[model samples]
Target: MSEQTGKQMSKEEKDARFEAELLPVLDPLYNFAYRLTLDEDDANDLVQETYLKAYRFFDYFEQGTNAKAWLFRILKNSFINEFRKKSKQPAKVDYSEVEGYYNTEDVEGESGVATTTDMRTESVQDLIGDEVASALNALPVDFRTVIILCDLEGFTYEEMAKILDIPIGTVRSRLHRARNSLKEKLEKYAKSMGYNGE
Candidate 1:
């Protein structure tokens, strides 16, 4: 790879750093995706698409820069684009009934136990994690995004602005509003748990 001097680099060297550096950020990418989409399948697909796009455009990436931030920008853009495109489409028809018909023999195999997992395994909010997650999930996507970027990812306002493609002032404003909204949500949860706002 180039020596951070904006010099030319060989493809092998680029590939080496691309894998070495970018792969480490995959967990954070997936976590960010999950927080954005709130669906495991969607998050997984978003992460996959981000990686593919990033790899295809690796030549444009500067060496010795903040790879995580770069990767995050790509992921956030991908999520927005993909989700927006999906929102514009009509609802899809699921074919689970036909699939289930074919799986009947497997479902009835051996002990014939019911395959469905019990939702009661986890209480609403599950005391803390679920409560916090539900509150976060309830937030508007824009506010949830600021929380994930600024608070969760620990990005500075300037860094967040660059990643989010917004002005630093806008980043600060959004972060303020988002935090306030999240606090209100958590306060409700705390009240439910007898916290009394202490």
Candidate 2:
């Protein structure tokens, strides 16, 4: 049956369909929202708003299409249109001074001696997850959103492009830049914590 026919379903049927199809996407949506807002309260608000919009427009959803992508698109649009508008902050900081840090050569002496410790030697990922999260939080909202959607949330580049209403090329480039930016931030944090470049 076509999606339009499905939309004419009874309330119970609609609810059943929604639960079966859409509910599974909630956790990912929540994670995406949390990363975007970086505040529990704001994340809750965004998720709630996303659901409301989704529920209201559920009939328009074409069955067999990617429900998660559809929901993400709604949530992203809501964020940009509503939440993003209210926050008139700059998207990027003046990190020019820190730019050189990223350009620094790998941990090798001029004589080609390996000076840096191997990152795999220390299982500090768990210890640093929170710090990495904080660094992600400190990033510009746009970059943070892309990172969470692509990395943490595990959305494909195409899915993210659909969600963000951007071209696939833009999605790839943004994800690359965001990851690089995140790595730079985490490296700074690691240094501060005396991680010895490991």
Candidate 3:
């Protein structure tokens, strides 16, 4: 839009560009949000808030940059702000989870559907994926986040550093410790599946 930039985009052009560049990252962004909050509703809210803030401050976003990283940074900040606010209040339980537990009858009952474990012989990958997800989720938020950003999302150390607003060294340290923690968590599952520590 600036004359000096040699490219002038109208409002419609900007909107189109924004959608073209940013929309594709929505799912990954939502995945990151879910991993952070561990709640579908919270993740949706976080993603919505991220888009709103990104759109509001679109002018500050430098074009041709890593839009995903930018959106992640915004989402991380929002999650932190929300976390702080929630921490101040008394903890609230999700009654629906309790109610569902009580109401459900033999969750794996008469329905002939096979669960991840049940189909392990046919798809070891699916079972391992579930184990990995469970192990990953067991990690503290900071550790889980580093693993998600680095290993899962495939962000480089530098990009993760920027997204997390930490030094590259800290990112590396955190990721290293996070991986060790995850490995420890998954070791039992791995051994059970015939993967000895050797």
lDDT top scorer: 3
Per-residue lDDT for 1-198 in model 3, tens only?
354354656678779988998899999999999988877988898899999899878878889999999999999999998754764535644433443453244233332243434774767677678768877777788998999998889999999999999999999999999999788766655554556789
RMSD of each: 10.3, 7.2, 6.7
Query: What's the CA RMSD of model 2 in angstroms?
Result: 7.2
User: Model 2: how far is 2 from its true place, Å?
Assistant: 18
Off by over 4 Å in 2: 1-7, 86-126, 193-198
lDDT of 3: 0.80
Candidate 2 structure, TM-score to reference: 0.73
* Residue lDDT tens for model 2, 115-174: 124345656676467667767776777888888877777889888888888999999898
Each model's lDDT comes to 0.75, 0.75, 0.80
Question: How close to the true structure is residue 160 of candidate 2, measured as C-alpha lDDT?
Answer: 87
Lowest lDDT 10-mer window, candidate 2?
107-116
Clashing residue pairs in all predictions, respectively, total: 1, 0, 0
Q: Across residues 13-114, which tens digit of lDDT does each residue of candidate 1 receive?
A: 777988998999998889999988777888888889999999878878887888899999998998887765774544522223333343344433331222
Q: After superposition, how far is residue 54 of candidate 2 from its true place, in Å?
A: 0.9
